[model samples]
Target: MTPLPIAAPLTIAIDGPAAAGKGTLAKRLAAHYGLPYLDTGLLYRAVGRLADEQGVDLDDAEAAGAVARALDAGAIDEAALRGREAGELASRVAAHPPVRAALEAFQRAFAADPRGAVLDGRDIGTVICPGARVKIFVTASAEVRARRRTDELAAKGRTVEYERILAEVRERDARDAGRAAAPLKPAADARLLDTSELDIETAFRAACAIVDQAPH
Candidate 1:
C-alpha cells in the first residue's frame, strides 16, 4: 500500500451513530491514504451475533463478554451482521462494560500501528483513540439516517418501513448516548461533519480536507 502524504503514526478516528456514513467515509479515506481500515462497530456486532447464536441472553453481561473474549475478529462473518436485528443485538451487548473492555485492546493495537490506520465506530474518537492525530464526528438527522438505512435494506431486497427505522434510529441514539460504558459522543477536538445534506462525494471531500489540515 502507498503511504499517506502525512507523517507516520497518523491515526484517524472517525466516530458516529448508525447509518451516518462514517463507515463509507472511513473506507474511502483509508483507500485514499493507503491506510489499514477497521470498522470497530463490527467487533460488537460479531460478538452480539455469536452470543445470540449460542442462546445467551442478550442482556447478560458475562455471557456477552465471554463471546467478545473468544471472538476471532478476522473470522467474523460480515455477511450475517448487516441488518436491523444484528444492529439491535449489538447495541444491547455493547452496553456491557465487560464487552467493551474485552475489545478495547484489539482496537488500540490496531491504532498503534506505525504505518497508521483509520478506525470508525461510536467511540473511536472518545474512547478507543483519544490521542489519534485526527478525529471526525460524522452525523446526520435521524430522519435522514433512517431513510438511508431503509433504502439500503430495500436495495438488498429486504422490506422495511421508514417509520419503524426512524424510531429505531432514535432509540439507538438515546441508548448509545445514555450507556454507562463508552457512551457515544464526540471527542473534544473532533471536527464535526453533518452529512444530512451532503452526498457521499461531498462528504468525502470535506473529510479529506479535515485530514489534510491535521498537524502531521
Candidate 2:
C-alpha cells in the first residue's frame, strides 16, 4: 500500500451518527494516507454480540461493561455485525458509560500507533480522540441517510421496509444524541462535512483535504 502523505504520524478521528457517510470517508482517507482504519462502532457491536451470546440483558449495565472490557478485537465478525438486530443492540449497549470507557484504552493505543490510524464512530472526536490532529464530523439529512441504508441492505438481499429503517435511524440519532456519556455531537474543533448532496468520492475528497490542511 502507498504510504499516507503526512509530515508525521497522527490520529484522524471521524465522528458522525448512523448512515452519515463517515465510514466511507474514513475508509478512503485511511487508504489515501496508508493508515489502518478502525470502525469504532465495531467495538460496540462486539460487546453487544458477546452480551447477547451470553444471554445478558441488554440493560444490564455491569454485565455489559464487563463484556466490553473483555472484548477481543480478534473475536469480532464484521459481516455478522451488519445484521439489523446486532446494530440496534450495539447502539443500546454503547449508551452505557462503562462500555464506552472500557474501549477507550484500545482506541487510544490504536491512535498512538507508529503507523498512524483513522477511527470513525459516534464519538471518536468528542471523546475517543479529542486531541486527534484531524477531526471530521460527517453528517447527512435523515431521509437521505435512510434511503442510502435501504438501498445497501436491499443490494445485500436483506429485506427491510424503508419506513421502518427510517424510523430506526431517527430513533438511533435520538438515543446517541441524548446519551449521557460522550453524546453524538461534533467536537468544537471538528470540521463538519454535510454530505447530503455529495457522492462518496466527493465527500471523501473533501475529508482528505481537511486532513491534509489540518495542523499536526
Candidate 3:
C-alpha cells in the first residue's frame, strides 16, 4: 500500500474495548500515514504490572497513581504486559482518577507529534485527543472478542477455556464502561466501525477510508 499524503500534523485516535482489533488497526493506519503509533493502553498495563510487582494494593489509588507517575513509558516490557492478567490489572488501575491524570500528559505529548500519530486505547478519542483529526471507535461483539482473545492466548501456549474467557471479557467491559474516570465510550464525533465479521485487512482498508474522507 502507498503511504497516505500528510500535509500537516494528523492525529488518529482509535478507541474500543479489549480484543476489538483497534490496536492492530491503529498500527496499520500509523504506518500507512507515516505517523508514530502509541498503544496507550500499555501505559496503564505497565503501571498495573509495576504495582503488582511491588506488592501494592491494586485498589489503592494513591499507590497506583504513584506507579503511574513513576512509569517509564518508553521502557515498558511489552512482552510481559499481554494476556488476560495484564488486561484485568490495567482495567483496575485505569479506573483511578489520579492514575489517569498522571499518565494523561504522556498521551497528550505523544499525540502532539508534529508529523502525526495514531493512539489506541479505551479513551483515546474521548479524553486523550478529543480534537484528533480522525477518531474511530472500533468494536466487535463480546463473543467474537472473547474468541479472538482465547485463540491468541492458546497460540502462546496458554490453555484457556472459552466460557471463562467470555465471562472475563464481559466483566472487563462492564468495569471499563462503568469506571468514573474516562469510561470507555465513543467520542461524539467519532466514526463507529463494527468489526464482528471483518478481518484485519478489511478493517484496515475501512479505517484508511475513514481517514481519507476526514477533513485534514
Candidate 4:
C-alpha cells in the first residue's frame, strides 16, 4: 500500500507594531509548518515605491488605487523596501481606502494558497486574514521596539538614532491604529505574544504552541 498524503489548512495570521518581532516569528512558524510565508506590508511598500517613481501623490486615492491594482505581488523586492522613507510613503498610501481595497484581493488570494501560508503585518489578524486558523498578535513596548529597530538598522550601516526611530514607531503606531480602514488591531479571539520581555526564540516557541493547539 502507498502512503497517504496529509493536508492541513493552517493559516497563521500575525499582527503587531513595527519591530515587535512578529515578522521574524512568522518566518519561524512558517518554516516549522512547512508553509509559504508572506510579509504583507511589503505589498504596500511595493506600491508606495512605485508611486514615488511615478511622482504620484501617495494621498491621491484614485492614482494610488490605480497604481496598486496595476502592480503585482511577485514584483516586490523585500531588500529594496527596507527604509524609513519608503515606509512613510507606504503608510500614506495605505491610508487610502481605494488603495487598501486594491491590495485586499491579492492578500486574500495568497492566504488561500493550497500549501497554506503565514502572513505577518500590522493588520493580518484583524483584517487581512481574520479567519486564519491561528492568530497571534505580537507586540512590545515602544522603547523596546525602537531598540530592536535601531540595532537592525545599525547592522546594515544605516546608523539612525534610537530616539528618532522611537518617535517614528510611535507615529506609525498611531497612524496604523487610528486609520479608518482595517486598523492595526488584533482579532478578539487572537492570542497576544508580547516580545518586550521575550527573545525571538521564546516568541517563536509561543507562536508554535499557539499553532499546535489550533483545531485543524
Candidate 5:
C-alpha cells in the first residue's frame, strides 16, 4: 500500500491513464479511510450519455455544455455509462472546456467535505485539487493496459479485438494528453505508481503506504 502523510482528514487525488488501476485503488483507499470516492470519469461519461440520448452532436460544444450543466448526479447509471456509444461521446465531450468547468463544482464540493475523499481521473491532482496533500499518479505501459483491458472484457463476455482496443487506448491517451483543459499529467508533487505488474491488492497497499507516510 502507498503510505499517506495526512495527519487528519484530507483529500487524496489519484490521477492516471486509462486502465492504470487508479479507479480501483481510489475506491479501496476511500473504503479503508471511510471516505467518499469520486470517479470523475463517470461525470464525463454521464454527460456524454445524456448528449447521445438527446441527439446532441458530440462535436457541438454548446450543446455538450448545456447537457453538462443540467446533469443530475443521481441519474448516472454505471452500466449505461459504459456503453461504446457513451464512451466515444465522453471522449468527445471531455474535450470541451465548458463541460469540464460545469462539472468542476460537483467534484470540488465532494472533495471539500469534512470526510476525506478520494478522486481519480486524468487531472484530479492538477485541476480538481491542487492543494491535495496526497497525490498519486498511477500508470502502466500502454501495451500492458491494453492487455489487461482486453482480458477484462473477455472475462465479462464482451467481444473485443485486442488490436482494436489497443488502438482506441492509444487514441484516448493522445486526446486526453492533448486537451487544453486539465490534460492528463502528473502534478510535480504527486508520487508515481507504475503498476504494470502489480495486482489491485498490491497497488492498494502501496498507495496506502504513500498516504500513511504523507504529512497531513
Candidate 6:
C-alpha cells in the first residue's frame, strides 16, 4: 500500500545539536520563503520552565511529561526560558519518552500546515518532518559552538564562563545523542552543513542554496 502524500507547501526541517546555528539558519530560511518558523527547542524549554515554576523535580519523568502535555506555546514567555539554567533543565526533560511523545503531535501538526513552515530541533528532520521538502542537519564542532554560545550570552548581558559553557555543551551533546527517544541524528535524506568555519551569513546562504536546489 502506498502512503498518502504530504499536504502542499514546502516544509523545511533544520536540525542540529546545541548552538550549531540551526536556529539562525531556520529563521533566515523562513524569512526568505515567508514561512512560519518554529524553534522546537523552545517547546521543551517551556516545559522545563513550567517544571521549575511549579517546583517539580527535573528527574521526575512523569512530572515533566505532564508539563509537556499541558504546554501552551502562546502563553510561554520566551524571555523566561532564555538562560543557561533553563536550557539544562530542558535537556533533562527532553530525554523523557513520554515528554517527547506528548510534543510530537504538536510538532507534526505544525509541519503539516499547507502554508509551509520551517522548524529547527534535534529531531525535526528525522522524526517531526521526515517528508519535508528540504531537510538540513546543521552542525559544528563543540568548541566552535561553545564559542558562539558564549558570544551570544555575553551580548545578551548574561555572565557565564566559557569553560563551564563548553562543558555543558558537550554534556548536552552526549545526552542528546545517547538518549533512547528520538536520539539526535541526521535523517537519511538530509543535507549536512558543517558551520564550524562558516559565518552566519555564509551558512545561511549555503542553506539557501540547498533549499533552492531541492526538487519541489
User: How well does candidate 6 score on lDDT at residue 63?
Assistant: 86
Each model's C-alpha lDDT?
Answer: 0.94, 0.89, 0.93, 0.87, 0.89, 0.90
Q: Candidate 5 residues 68-150, lDDT tens each?
A: 99999887888777644566678889999989999999999988988778999888899999989799999999999989989
CA deviation > 4 Å runs, candidate 1: 1-8
Task: Report the lDDT tens digits of candidate 1 across residue range 2-117.
Answer: 97685658799999999999999999999999999998888999998899999999888998999999999889888789888899989999999999999999999999989999
**Which candidate ranks first by lDDT, i.e. highest?**
1
Question: Candidate 1 or 2, higher lDDT?
Answer: 1
- Misplaced by over 4 Å in model 5 are 1-8, 83-85
Q: What does candidate 3 score on TM?
A: 0.95
Clashing pairs in 1: none
lDDT winner between 4 and 5, please give it: 5
Local accuracy of candidate 6 as per-residue lDDT tens digits, 79-193: 7787778888889999999899999998999898789899999999888888898999999999998998899899989888999889999999999999999999999999999
Candidate 2, residue 199: the lDDT equals 94
TM-score for each candidate, following the candidate numbering: 0.95, 0.93, 0.95, 0.93, 0.93, 0.93
> What does candidate 1 score on TM?
0.95
Q: What lDDT would candidate 1 get against the real structure?
A: 0.94
Scanning candidate 5 in windows of ten residues, the lowest lDDT window is 80-89
List, residue by residue over 56-96, the lDDT tens digit for candidate 3. Answer: 99999999999999998879999899767998999999999
In candidate 2 the C-alpha lDDT for residue 43 amounts to: 92
lDDT of 5: 0.89
Question: What are the runs in model 3 whose C-alpha is more than 4 Å off?
Answer: 1-8
